[model samples]
Target: MSNRVDELEGQVAELRAAVNGLTEELVETKDRLRKLEAEAASEAEPPAERETKSDDHVVVVEQEQDDVDVATDSLGSDTASEAEPGEAAVEPEETTENDTNKSTDDIIVA
Candidate 1:
């Protein structure tokens, strides 16, 4: 029948439109991936083009490290002087065998 033939043609047209939409999305995604790869390549520095710090830079770093060590040593002595004479460090009480047996003997849930 002509009616059935026309219905089939309409379905075919919808399938073609769907395929075209998906094809366009695939092309755009591929283009975006290529651009990202190119950008990453440009940002990378090759080994031959790498720069090194001079002797002055090394000396400056050593002086900074010495300053840090002196500051930490001063801080350590301050903490040692701050401990109170009355406050002793508390240690946990040692568990007895009877106490362990009593605890594990019963479990109460409320």
Candidate 2:
């Protein structure tokens, strides 16, 4: 009976050691998973889309009214005649430095 009790006690000790080892491994694994998830979330967003602030400074986007054309030409221009109500006007970008002689009627094939 004593020998049988000793054997049972040894088995219980082995089981307790195994459970402790498995618990430590589980905790370590959970920590590693949390770190990996944080890294993935940070990488998913670009620098422009992320909300960020530095030293009490925040970034702001400003739209200048001077860049947009709100009034139509009264001199019978094609842009003014062809524009529809409730539609935004589009201004052509200057592509060349020597555009002094270029007309609005010129077709840019590129």
Local distance difference test, per candidate?
0.84, 0.73
Which numbered prediction scores highest in TM-score against the true structure? 2
* TM-scores, one per candidate: 0.39, 0.42
Residue pairs whose backbone atoms clash in candidate 2: none
* lDDT for model 2: 0.73
Model 2 compared with the native: what TM-score?
0.42
How far residue 28's Cα lies from its native spot in candidate 2, in Å, is: 0.2
lDDT, candidate 1, 35-58, per-residue tens: 999999999864423344567556
- Residues 6-103 of candidate 2: C-alpha lDDT, one tens digit per residue: 99999999999999999999999999999999999888854323334544677555334433333233444776678798898689996774575466
